[model samples]
Target: MNRTPEDRIVELGLVLPDVVSPAGSFQPSVKSGPYVYTSGQLPIVNGKLVMTGKLGQTVTTQQAAELAAICALNALAAVRAEVRELSRVRRIVKVVGFVTSVPDYSDQPAVVNGAGDLLTEIFGRAGTHARSAIGVVALPRNAPVELELIAEIAD
Candidate 1:
């Protein structure tokens, strides 16, 4: 909570993208009290999906990891839009990452780490938080990963 999140973003060379409108009825994020909850974010870079396939089948773990990072970035973008100030974040509360994978694949944690690690690099310890890396039967648009986040904001 020492170094500001804006400074952290700069340290990590990350700039939040504009929060894209939800493809459906849901909002990108909702703020309650000092916390912001972001909707699940798909890995869309430059407004295009990088790849699409179930992990351990047509997709490699490395690619899935990268996709997860993009999801995290998207989640942050939503947070910025919802709260109007990334620097107001005191710390990341938690992350829920979902992966589309083959039945035999059990590397969901590593894939989600792509997002978790980026948070650490960007916010240092303030980014550290509880998390769940889940493997699901499938994801929307067959994305390799989807990420959602909860963050605590400063008054």
Candidate 2:
């Protein structure tokens, strides 16, 4: 039997967390046609932000990268909440990551790679997608990293 995406996630020693409630009026994810778009997800676990601070300052690059992975995981949870099954995903279309950084920090790509690598590990080739990593002065709830995803789903 083929290993499902959830199984791959489990094999990697990660459990997808429950879909987080929207902080504001916006929905966590929306499905349109064959696509599902997730709102930007913070590095929150168990209803709390896991880490906060500006990268290259209180938060190191490595730490921010790990937080980015958590944000990706949350984004996946949002996707699953909408589609009701990970196996329904046809492919990850795109990823947009935001990193809060101190002045002069320029390693945003490496930080967001934490998410990209995890997606590839779980979904194999389908996980590969176009991506944008942006650096900002701050983010909602003071999260160091946030991630959003666009995925294509099967009919």
Candidate 3:
């Protein structure tokens, strides 16, 4: 029996959170042709941020990494909202992560691995994708991390 992405998520002991409503004029995700582009997703749970602070200041690398994973969950929620099913995703094409941190910090990749690792666990090889981890001055809601995902979908 073939397992679907939703099944894989359950097997990995995770659940997709409710999609965060767009706070701006943009849609949470837009599907064009065979791809879905998502807006940046924050580490929110139950309609609130999990934490707020700069990564190298009040937040530790580990904490930021965990938050990155949460952002991935929110990203998945956005994809589901667009495609109507997790299994519709053929593969994750790319992930762009932004971390709010003090100027001197330079461990962005380690923080982003949290999301990549979880994605792999949930989607297997399909989760693997190109990624960029960027350090920024700040993000919306003062979130420690934010992530945007691009996925190729099936018809």
Off by over 4 Å in 3: none
RMSD of each: 1.8, 0.6, 0.8
- Kindly give the number of clashing pairs for every candidate: 0, 0, 0
**Model 3, C-alpha of 144: deviation from truth (Å):** 0.5
lDDT tens readout by residue for model 3, 1-155: 98988888888888888899889899989999999999999999999999999978999999999999999999999999999999999999999999999999999999999999999888889999999999999999899999999999999
Q: What lDDT does candidate 3 reach at residue 127? A: 96
Q: Which candidate order results from sorting by TM-score in descending order?
A: 2, 3, 1
Q: Write the per-residue lDDT of candidate 2 for residues 9-116, one digit (tens) a residue.
A: 899999999999999999999999999999999999999999889988899889988998898889999999998889999999999999999879999999999999
* TM-score, candidate number 1: 0.93
**Regions more than 4 Å wrong, model 2:** none
Q: If the candidates were sorted by their lDDT against the true structure, best first, what order would they fall in?
A: 3, 2, 1
State every prediction's TM-score relative to the real structure.
0.93, 0.98, 0.97
Greater TM-score among 1 and 2 belongs to 2
Question: In terms of TM-score, which candidate is stronger, 1 or 3?
Answer: 3
Which candidate wins on TM-score? 2
lDDT (Cα atoms) of all candidates against the true structure: 0.88, 0.93, 0.94
- Which residue pairs come into collision in candidate 1? none
* TM-score pick, better of 2 and 3: 2
